[model samples]
Target: MPSDTLNQFLNDNLNELKEQGLYNEIDVVEGANGPRIQIDGRDLVNLSSNNYLGLATDERLKEVAKDAVDSHGVGAGAVRTINGTLDLHVQLENKIAEFKGTEAAIAYQSGFNCNMAAISAVMDKNDAILSDALNHASIIDGCRLSKAKIIPFEHSDMDDLRQKAKEAKESGQYNKIMIITDGVFSMDGDVAKLPEIVEIAKEFDLITYVDDAHGSGVLGKGAGTVKHFGLQNEIDFQMGTLSKAIGVVGGYVAGKQNLIDWLKVRSRPFLFSTSLTPADVSATTKAIDLLMESTELQDRMWENGDYLKKGLKELGFDIGNSETPITPCIIGDEKTTQQFSKRLNEEGVYAKSIVFPTVPKGTGRVRNMPTAAHTKEMLDEALTIYEKVGKEMNII
Candidate 1:
């Protein structure tokens, strides 16, 4: 049995969440999360996964992963600082550096962990972090863990960032200042105004960091947003994930040799946690090699994105200002948005509703992720269902 105090706290919080309509009931996908997913034995047109390039279920990656497991086993045995650093891990890091156009790179268990490790490794009590208002939760937690003064600028507002940066620098209170933002804002699919942000960083002598989790496999011909703007040398930290686009499970921080050296020594997760398995390392290396070899998958992903966007627009759905493949059909009220998603699932589509806290209140939306693996037939079916449901809900 749980402790009385803990039980009571959990119950109260859960009840409050339910009453506020904020409880999220997770769905169980029975098979691989691909262009089509199975739930309760029913296959649905999958538009909810972050498998942007469809490499998660790629045969080549699977073959390499299996071969690695046979050669190196399933686990890295100890913490990275101890005996866990394998040859495959070193090779993977080198591949990441080459892929991102950085001098050196370091990998973490997850993108969230990378943020936690990298932020606290450098910035601390005497520092300040000027973060975007709508940055990912991991970024928020990372900044807090640094024990630094955090000032949030309005989302994608360059003027606000510039003003905040100026104020923070002129105050002379912090020993160091950093500006952090997502390379691609996941919720709205908007690209960050990195050029302007870089200009501000230069003016204030601020350290620049961009979390390219969503942009790594989808932008700049699969190189990412830093490369998209040709500002590879300007950004201090280029953080990315292997999970979403690479169809694997890990994250990385790529930068100069000095920064990578600092992180290797100071990053808590790198020092304390076990390194990635040999299979993950080898498969990730293969994924990077594939990305470097061709732009076929990235190009297909964009084409699919454009096709879906045009279909949704023609069906009279409002997809907010998105610059990437992520599509969000705005449906103001939380309950209605939830109902719309429910109907979509019933009609054989798998898009999910995102509401309050994940997004602003009263701006609930159904987020759609179109991957390179999705067929035109699958998209056509999804659009047909969407049109039917929209009209039925009087949304279109």
Candidate 2:
């Protein structure tokens, strides 16, 4: 039996969340998460996935993954330091390094783990991190785990970042100072001012770190945000996920050989957690290869994004300022945004609403991720549904 104390505590919090309209009910997809997905036996156009290049379900990646599984086993039997670092893992890291234009790279179980590992590995109580206000939760947690003083600047405000960097550097109260940001802000689809950030880092002599999870397969012709600005060598840490654009599962930090060596030696996750499976490593390697070979998938993804944004704007939706393929239709009120997303799902489009806490209180939105896999017909259908629902709900 469960402890009464634990049950009561959980029940009370859950009841409060339900009353505030903050409780989330997850919808389960019935099959592979692709351009279209089935939920509750209804087919719906999926605009909520991070498969920017449509490589998650690509046949070539599938074949490689299957072959790896047949040749190797399902799991990496031990922690990486204890012999779980398979040849496939090494190959994946090498591929990541080459693709990112870095001297070397290190892989972790997931993008989330990469943050926890890398941040804590290098930073400590004597260090300070100047972080962007809108960085991901993983980055926040990682910074905390480092036990370093965290200084947050206004989102994408170069002036604010420079001011904070100056204060931290001149104070001389910390051994090291690092500036961290999301290469692409996920909520608004607006890109980070990397050029300005690099300039600031250079002036302050601060180490630069970018979490390029959303930018990896969508920016820099699919190389990433660092390469987008041709600052691959300037940035100290280039962290990204294999799960998002790569269409696999894992994360990595690409940088100088010294940084990679230090992470391998000190990162707790790499030392304690088992490495990624052979299949995941092989598939990720192949995905990077495809990305390097051509930019067709990224081009298609951008085309879909442009079409969606134009259609929504024509229908009187306030799409935010997004330079990337990530489209957020701002709906203002939280309840309205949730209702809008619900209507979209009911009408055959599957876009999830991002409400308060995830974003600001009144700036709720329905985030649409246009992938390369979506067809023009599918997007057109989605636009029609949006118009119908927007008019019916008085949103347009």
Candidate 3:
């Protein structure tokens, strides 16, 4: 007594994925995702966490969470439009604005929700969005939800973007046009050409948007990509995740006062969804404060990235073109990449394989995330394992 259509579709999709060797099996981390992680009852050098700044387990952030829990209980009572906008929310937003060099800021429950809320709130069917081809899935969905004509410019292709923006303006295909891109490409770790992007935007009078989820805690001495390029005022939307480098949970948008004002009233997620809990909000504030305080974590993260990339490249393995700390050990076949990950797991390293759908087919790679928490000892051990596995798999 099964629903025939639903069951058939699910089974068909599952079978297809399995046949294509793309069916992913999930792994369990027994405890905290630290630099050294316990996976399936073994200690492994973890190189797959976005906890780049190691603030996820920082003592100061923990204390802030404890204090908030004691003072504000657990959850915000209701949605922001209802009874949920606590004084802490206002305080956190203010700190974020100051840190991001913006007139105002607003937080969302998650980074994905930030895109969902911000895009549709400002633009609609009458408008159009010029988005980068490799923009995050959240951004793509946000554009779709807005009912806007999504014009995907080539990835980091300035000439292509300029041509497309010019054509869109001339055709009068839609209303407002905004260009959105990730400040740093997460998988490849290459930075977006924001200076060129901004110049194009000014020429076309297009609104500039950058989702600096990966760049905030790493670039511009922790001020983020907009500040790195000295275009903080030129960009219209500065969206980011508190979860990544901030090492907390949530997202935000920093921009002009009027833009923030409009979003506060119009953004569906901000208005309808309940706000982040007191603990999360307060810890995030502490994270921003910490980043402003010192460059220790950012510096350590770069050291580790360079160390790992150098070691891997010396082993004669292809480490793709990466401008940031993200390191990918390129393995051309999906099944082989997964097998290599499995073999590395046996050798006490926990870098994960990224395959088709995340990247183009035949470009499968084992993506590594070297964080501030990783020590030279840990990285050396991981490098030793990578060398062994690369040779065993004939990948070097």
Off by over 4 Å in 3: none
TM-score for all models, in order of appearance: 0.99, 0.98, 0.98
Query: For each candidate, what is the lDDT?
Result: 0.95, 0.94, 0.93
Clashing pairs in 3: none
Candidate 1's residue-wise lDDT over 232-319, tens digit each?
Answer: 9999999999999999999999999999999999999999999899888888999999999999999999999999999999999999
User: Could you tell me the TM-score of candidate 3?
Assistant: 0.98
Candidate 1 residue spans exceeding 4 A from truth: none
Q: How many backbone clashes does candidate 2 have?
A: 0
Q: Write the per-residue lDDT of candidate 3 for residues 254-316, one digit (tens) a residue.
A: 999999999999999998889999999999999999899999999999999999999999999
Candidate 2: residue 321 lDDT (0-100): 92
Candidate 1 lDDT at 289 equals: 98
